[model samples]
Every structure is written in structure tokens, then in C-alpha cells.
Target: MKVVVAGSSGLIGTALVAALRRDGHEVTRLVRRPANARDEFRWDPARADLDERALRGADAVVNLCGAGIGRRRWNGSYKQELRDSRIVPTDVLASAAAAAGVRTLVNASGVHYYGGDSGDRIVTETSPAGTGFLAGLCRDWEAAAQPAADAGVRTILLRSAVVLARHGGMLGMLYPLYFLGLGGRLGSGRQYVPWISLDDEVGAILFALTDDALSGPVNMVGPAPVTNAEFTRALGRALHRPTPLMVPAFALRVTVGEFADEGILHGPRAIPTALEDAGYSFRHPTIGAALAATVGRS
Candidate 1:
């Protein structure tokens, strides 16, 4: 299959591109800079500019465009940046895919679509949209891809979890701290931490690209659910370090502001119901296995 990928420089995007190529799929990458490689094409999502050839004759277009949610303290400006960075590029790509008559449009979203602090309630693809800023952002982000679905193209909204990787992502920020024996739980450590391994994250995208039975919102997360405290312990165990510290909820608010609450202190108990129903298997089904593959390698 011929696949065109946007946001090809991100953590998930990088893995997805390599996986697609390794699996014998022809891949074209959309870059913001000038195109230099045969498989590269330049596109400007902010200006809604994409070369006519970018999506031509493509079987699928996978959009992973979004600013890092936890990259900065949440100010009014940064929040707007998060929305623009995701919704704009998604709108452009979805429109282009529709115009080019692409067969599939796999757009990126987040498990936060179900809102923060889902408590013990299990979230599925059929769950309704939740409240809060992140949920609204994800809701809008997924809505931006409506053009493709309306045009009769099979569109898949990938509501991804916090991706655990060896080098970069959530683990990247925590690896050093955990290795130094300073890792600890945030807040009361009772919030659910929706997470997935980098391998399965990439594998799920590939699976969604070809599985005709899958469409709409699919939760790309681990089958097993773990609380933040459980995650902290698992990560500590994986690194062979003692996690004896705790970051209070007030301190977290003072440190990272609003993100400390929504991004860290709260998360959904999201499960991969759609993926499992579609017969997609996970490489790291448990959090312990996921941390071993990621933190153990590091």
C-alpha cells in the first residue's frame, strides 16, 4: 500500500514511518521544510499549503501532527498553540485526502478525549466525549478530519495513549530521575495512567491502515490499566531504583501549572476495545512488559 505520512518527525511518526517502510509499504513523508528526498514533499499546514502531488494516487494518509501537550506550562497562548498545531494540519490533510480520493485517512487524537480522571470507569471507543480543555482539544482535533470521512474515504481517529519509548516521550523525561532514585508518584497517585509501548503504538497504526472493519475513534492503548502509583512502582522496579519520594498536588500545580493536573494528576482508564475486537494483538499487553521493553533497554 502507498501511504503518505504527515508530522513524520515526531516520536510516534518516526516509528510509524520506519515500520511502514519495513513492512513493504511505499511511504511518502510530508515535511514542513523543503523537500530533499525522493519520498519527501513539503507542506505548510498553517498556511494550508500542500503540493498537489503529496496525496495523489495514495492508498492512505496518516496524520500525526500535534504539539507536545506536556512540552510547556499551560498558558493561554500555549493552549492555543496545541489546538492550532493539531487541528490545522489535520484539516489540511483531511481535505487533501478527500480531494485526492485517498482510500484511508488515519488521523491522530488522544485518549484524553474521554477527559481527565475517569476514576475506575473503563473507557471504550463508544464512550461519549468528556469535559475539560484537553478533551475539547482532542474533540476538535478529531473533528477536523470530517472532510475525508464525508467524502467516502475510510477515516480512522487514533485516540492514542501516553506512548512509552526508550529514548524520547514520557519515559525520556522520567528515565533519568528514576535512574537517580528520585522518581515518585504525583498527587495522590490514584489517577489512571493510560499508556502503551512504542512498538504497539506503531503496530496499531499499521493495523488500522489496512483493517477495513475499523474506522471512527479507536483507543490505541494497553489492554491492562494501571494507576499512577502502580505505574510509578512498575517504573521504579524496572529501573532497579527505590521510589521513596512523592510530589504533592500543590507542588505540581506550582511547577507545571494546569498541566500538572490535567496531564499528570489525571488520566483516563482507556482500553483498546476496538483494536482487540478487530483481532489486533499487542506486543506488550501489560505495563510491566512495556516498561521492561522501554526503561530496561535504556
Candidate 2:
């Protein structure tokens, strides 16, 4: 299969590109900078500028474009950046894919589409969009891909969980702290943490690219559900460290502002119902296994 990937420098994007190439799929990467390699194409999503050649004869176009939501304190400007960063690139790629008649469009989304603090409710692909800024951002982000689906291309919206990896992402920020014995639960440690391993995250994207019956929103999370406290303990156990500290909600709010509330204090109990139904097997099915695999390498 011929696959074109956008946001190829990101954590998930890098892994996905490598996995696609390893399997002998011809991969073309869309870069914001000048094209530097044979498999690279330059694109500007802010202006929705992309050469149709990027998508020509492509079996699938996987878009993973977005600014890091937790990369900065949420001011009005940063929030807008979050929305534009995702929506603009997605719109560009989707429109280009439609124009080139690409067979599949696998777009990135977040489990936060179900909103923060879903409590104990199980979130599935059919679950209605939830409330809050991130939810709205995700809604708009996925909606940007409508052109592709409308053009008869199979569109897959990956409502992905907090991806766990050895080097970057949530674990990256926490690894050093935990290694220094500063790791602990945030807030009351009761909020569900929807999460997935980097390996499975990449695997799921590859699965979505070829699985004809899979389209629409798919929750790319683990089969098992875990609360913040459970995750804290598991991570602590994995690192052979004691998680004895607790970060209060007030402290978190003072530290990271709105993100402290939505990104850390609350999360959905999202499950991979669609992926499981499609016969996708997870390499790290449990949080313990996931942390072990990630932290063992760190």
C-alpha cells in the first residue's frame, strides 16, 4: 500500500512512518519545510496549500497534525492555537485526499472528544460528543476531514488516548520526576486515565488504514480501564520508586492552569471497542504491561 503521512515529526507520526516502511509500504511524508528527501513533500496547512501529487495514487493519508495541548499554559491564544493547529492541517490533507481520490483518510483525534471527567461511564465510538474546550477542539478537528469522507474515501477518526512511550509524551514529563521520587497522584487520583502504548497506537493506525469496515470515530485506547491512582501505583512500581507525594488540585491549577484541570485532573474511561471488534490485538493490554515496556527501556 502507498501511504502519505502528515505531521511526520511528531511522536506518533514518527513511529507510524517507521512501522509503515518496515512493512514495505511505500510512504510519503508531508513536511512544512522544503522537501529534503525522495519520500517528502512540502505543504503549508495554515494556507491549506498542498500539492495534489502528495496524495496521488495513495492508498491512505494519515494526518497527525496538532500542537501539543499541554505544551503551554492555556491562554485564549494558546487555546486558539490548539484548534487551528489541528483543524487547519486536517482540512488541508482531507481536501487534498479527496481531490486525489485517496482510498482512506485516517485522521488523529483525542479521547477527550468524550470530554473530561467522564467518571465511570464507558465511552465507545457511538458516544455523543462531550462538553468543554478540548471536546469542541476535537469535534472541529474531526469535522475538518468531512471532505474526504464525502468524496467516497473511507475516513477513520482515531479518538486516541494519552499515548505512553519511553521517550516522549505524558511519560516523558513524568519519567524524570518519578525517577527522582517526586511522582504521585494528581488531584484526588480518581479520574480515569484513558491510555495506550506507543506500539499499539501505531499498530492501530496501520489496522485502520486497511480495515475496510472500520470508519468514523474509533477509540484508540486500551481494553482495560484504570484510574489515576491505579496508574500512579503502576508507574511507581514499574520505576521501582515510591509514589508518596500528592499534587493538589490548587497546586496543579497554579502550575499548568486550565490544562491542569482538563488534561491531568480528568479523563475518559475510553475503551477500544471498535479496534477489538475488528480483531486488533494489543501488545500491551494492561497498564502494568504498558508501563513496564516503556519504563524498562528508559
Candidate 1 is scored at a TM of: 0.98
Q: What does candidate 2's lDDT look like per residue over 1-298, in tens digits?
A: 9999999899999999999999999999999999999999999888888877778899899999999989988999989889999999998888888888889999999999999857889989988888899999999999999989999989999999999987899999999999999999999999999999999999999888888999999999999989999999999999999999999999999988888878899898988999999999999999999999999634
Runs with alpha carbons beyond 4 Å of true place in candidate 1: none
lDDT of 1: 0.93
lDDT of each: 0.93, 0.92
User: 1-298, model 1: which lDDT tens digit per residue?
Assistant: 9999999999999999999989999999999998999999999998999987889999999999988999988899999999999999999998899999899999999999999856789999999888889999999999999999999999999999999997898899999999999999989999999999999999999999989999999999999999999999999999989999999999999988988878889899999999999999999999999999887745
The per-residue C-alpha lDDT of model 1 at residue 77 equals: 94
Model 2 lDDT at residue 54: 75
TM-scores of all models? 0.98, 0.98
